[model samples]
Target: MDPEDGSGWADVSDRSHRIDDEMDRIVERLRDLAHTQRRFQDLLDAVMSVGRDLELPVVLRRVITTAMGLVDARYGALGVLS
Candidate 1:
């Protein structure tokens, strides 16, 4: 088939569309991975912060604050059961 033939053009167009679709999927996966990494890092940091304090009250306060921040909650509390 001639390079300038319409048949060749259709093949090129199809390949181009496939490449674009694949690239879009790759970009979406990368975004999701990045989001997951950030969430993991945040949780790790929160855990580390709570662990750094050996005092019970301090640890509980840090845990509560971290939990509230993670969930975007306006308020949080830790209730101890006797």
Candidate 2:
């Protein structure tokens, strides 16, 4: 069989397609990890902000807002204690 025949070309093409598909999957995984890492960092930052405040009211406000923001919510509430 000649190297330039259809069989050899088809084999090379199939391998190339498989490699491309694998590369796509890897890229998607990295993108997912990046998003997860960003979310984790945001939560960590929110925790640090809450910790930096000693006052109860400020801490409560930070907690409520951070929770809302993390979930992309437009509303949140914190009860006040008498």
Candidate 3:
């Protein structure tokens, strides 16, 4: 906008609002990235936890519990097929 008459003030205001809206979108995307990263880390930790056990019974239980925790499920089960 011209400093003397400020004839372009409306255009400048519109551009500023657009930029602010774009910034908000960018921030939301960053938050999503952070959440995804945390979930990935949790999965890695669960893998390590299951790996550290050498007993079959303990391993199976850990797998079920870990699956439930990862998916936020109230119930989990294990099925065997031969």
Candidate 4:
């Protein structure tokens, strides 16, 4: 029976396997793009939130916390050169 036929076994031809592999790669790339987009949006929102605060300390704390959370870091700190 031809592999292309809707038999119980999957198609094992080289071209078919290559197509499947390419499809899997495309799906993985799309997922990564979606995750990155979400992170970017979260960062943008964090920046906007800090922008609304007029107090310096509050703004600094918000920025540090937001940065830590976005990067999944357990600890974060900010240093001023001046």
Q: How many residue pairs clash in each candidate?
A: 0, 0, 0, 0
Residue pairs that clash (backbone atoms under 3 angstroms), model 3: none
Tell me model 1's lDDT, rounded to 2 decimals: 0.92
lDDT ranking from best to worst? 3, 1, 2, 4
Off by over 4 Å in 2: 1-4, 79-82
Model 4 bad stretches (over 4 Å): 1-12
Greater TM-score among 3 and 4 belongs to 3
Question: Relative to the unseen true structure, what is the C-alpha lDDT of residue 52 in candidate 3, on a scale of 0 to 100?
Answer: 88
Estimate the Cα RMSD of every predicted model relative to the unseen true structure: 1.7, 2.3, 1.6, 4.4
Give per-residue CA lDDT, model 1, range 7-77, as digits (tens). 88888889999999999999999999998899889899998899898999989999999999878899999
lDDT of 3 at 79: 97
- Model 2: per-residue Cα lDDT over 3-70, one tens digit each: 76668788788999999999999999999999999999999998888899899888898899999989
CA shift at 34, candidate 1, in angstroms? 0.8
Model 1 lDDT at residue 50: 90
Model 3, runs deviating above 4 Å: 2-6
